[model samples]
Target: MSSFSIRLYKDSDYEVVRGLFARGNLEHSHMAFRHAISVTRNWLFTLVMFLIPLCVTGSVILSILAVVIALSIIWICSRYVYSYYVDQCLSDDMLNIQKYYLQRDGYGFWVAESGGEVVGAVAAVPSSYSSEDKHTELKRLTVARSHRGKGIAKALCRTVIEFARNRGSDAVVLQTSLPQVDAWKLYEKMGFRKTLIIRESSLRYRIVDFVHFRYQYDLLANKLL
Candidate 1:
């Protein structure tokens, strides 16, 4: 904390906070889980709607109306279900950071210039989120879009991992999406390996994106040096 001087996020930094969450890794597991629940709910709703209507209505025109109603029910319920979990968990990184600081389970770093304007940001969350051994999820890593390719992302990543190590984490893990091809590459250079390859989609995202590998190092072993 002394090296970077971290503090809880203030209300005024909402926009920057939003960008941080928006910019973090997007996991396919989340999209896949949400979509599965949504699709299953819709299919079940359709069955109930049509089967129940059969008990009273027998006309062909009525049957067509039932089909339309089923589709509508599915769409509305899917969005509702999606919103519910998002409120419970930060499917986005920035909101997670705010929640982390608010709950005191996570930490954020805002790289600032000597004059005190923020230039980059990163966040780390508990690995219980991943259910692995003393691991931490490194997330919401971003440099301003204009500052791309200046190694700001690398610096932010280093900061977050160091923070995790200090917190006694076994290693750092991240789940990234297709939009961050460069991040995937960077993780590779930093010694992360693909731990899981989920082919199905999960929460919020719909595209066929690949979940990238996780990187790790033993801070305890290094401490002996």
Candidate 2:
């Protein structure tokens, strides 16, 4: 809907890209904290603890304290889970953009610019699990908060999908977390089907009720190639 263009990642975009990523990454913390508070284990613990104070002494102050403590615990767990993921991503391929996406064959990174400013970014790489089948994995699809809902995200996704198709990839696969509800919806709207659901094993992830959704867009099925 806005005037924008998608282009290959450039060296000068490094800091801006990472800054956008960090801010966008933190935006989901509220949802993560809410999810952690909703988990059966967490909620039950909080309920029981809060009730204990009321049942023992009928002290409103103590019950309030219990509730506060429970919320604090959930917040800490969610924060840890959120921070760890951002750190891992920033330290990994994102640390050396050129080496990870530009130099590698069948891999790419792109940024969407509007009014000469980067508003969105995405990358694709050969799927490690389905390389023999020529599958590509989409990663790091993000749009700046101020620029969302203007078709920037969709354009970035199409850029990766088309890049994969041109590379002879049979499908484009990607993983999203439960907190990224909008992201999975965009993938589905683009004809990507949910392929797998994984409950991460990390203690912090489990505490926050984090689940990963794997989606695949079959190029052959869509006759896109």
Candidate 3:
């Protein structure tokens, strides 16, 4: 296994880590789009609706043209909508890492380095949805594609979990989508349990229900036993 180190985030590492976050997420966008296409009934309905007109009119050329237009619209819209969250991460969190994480109490950002180069990152921040002080959120867990399966991601996750425990947190929670199969597996392997799942219901973005899974690791559960 390739050796790596996890350390606190520094201002100098901002740009590289930001790029990694964007690139890593874009890699998964293709899978998310594919899942949406496969599971969303709306896409099938749209195709059928457009085909019915061609069947009635017996105009093969118009039918093909209509199908092409419908597909174009679906593809374009799905890409844009799904990319919105990734864009938000860059705009809100990654770009303002210091203000959002380092500057706050009980919040931290970490980067994994291999051979003196940053290869992965993860963050633990106070959960806004939870009223308990012991609840922290794990976010932005990412690893470079070239360095994956070398325990880099697992190290980053452990860093966040250790950080949370050291700060007296009762639990560390995270959200991952269905497209991130590898990440979900890693979390489960690390003793994180699936606590809840959120499914998209909006009609406009229904093609990619954008399913989100919430996983949590209880820091005190083992100690209390």
Best by TM-score: 2
List candidate 3 segments past 4 Å from native. Answer: 222-225
lDDT string for model 1 (142-216, tens) is 555556576667767776677777777877888664335677788777666666654436533332222334545
Which segments of model 1 are wrong by more than 4 Å? 1-10, 20-99, 106-116, 201-225
What TM-score would candidate 2 get against the native? 0.94
Candidate closer to the true structure by lDDT (higher is better), 1 or 3 = 3
Clashing pairs in 3: none
Could you arrange the candidates by lDDT from highest to lowest? 2, 3, 1
> How many pairs of residues collide in each model?
11, 0, 0
Worst 10 residues of 3 by lDDT: 73-82
Write candidate 2's Cα lDDT for 1-225 as tens digits: 679999999999999898888888787888889888878999998898899999999998899899899888788877777677789999998999988899988889999999999988999988875546689999988999999999999989888889888888888999888888889998899899998999989777777888889999999998742
Q: How does each model score on lDDT?
A: 0.55, 0.88, 0.82
Q: What's the lDDT of the predicted structure labeled candidate 2? A: 0.88
TM-score of 1: 0.54
Q: Compared with the true structure, what per-residue lDDT tens digits does model 3 show for residues 65-184?
A: 777776666666566654677788888877789888899888899999999999999998897646888888999988999999998898888888788888889998998888889999
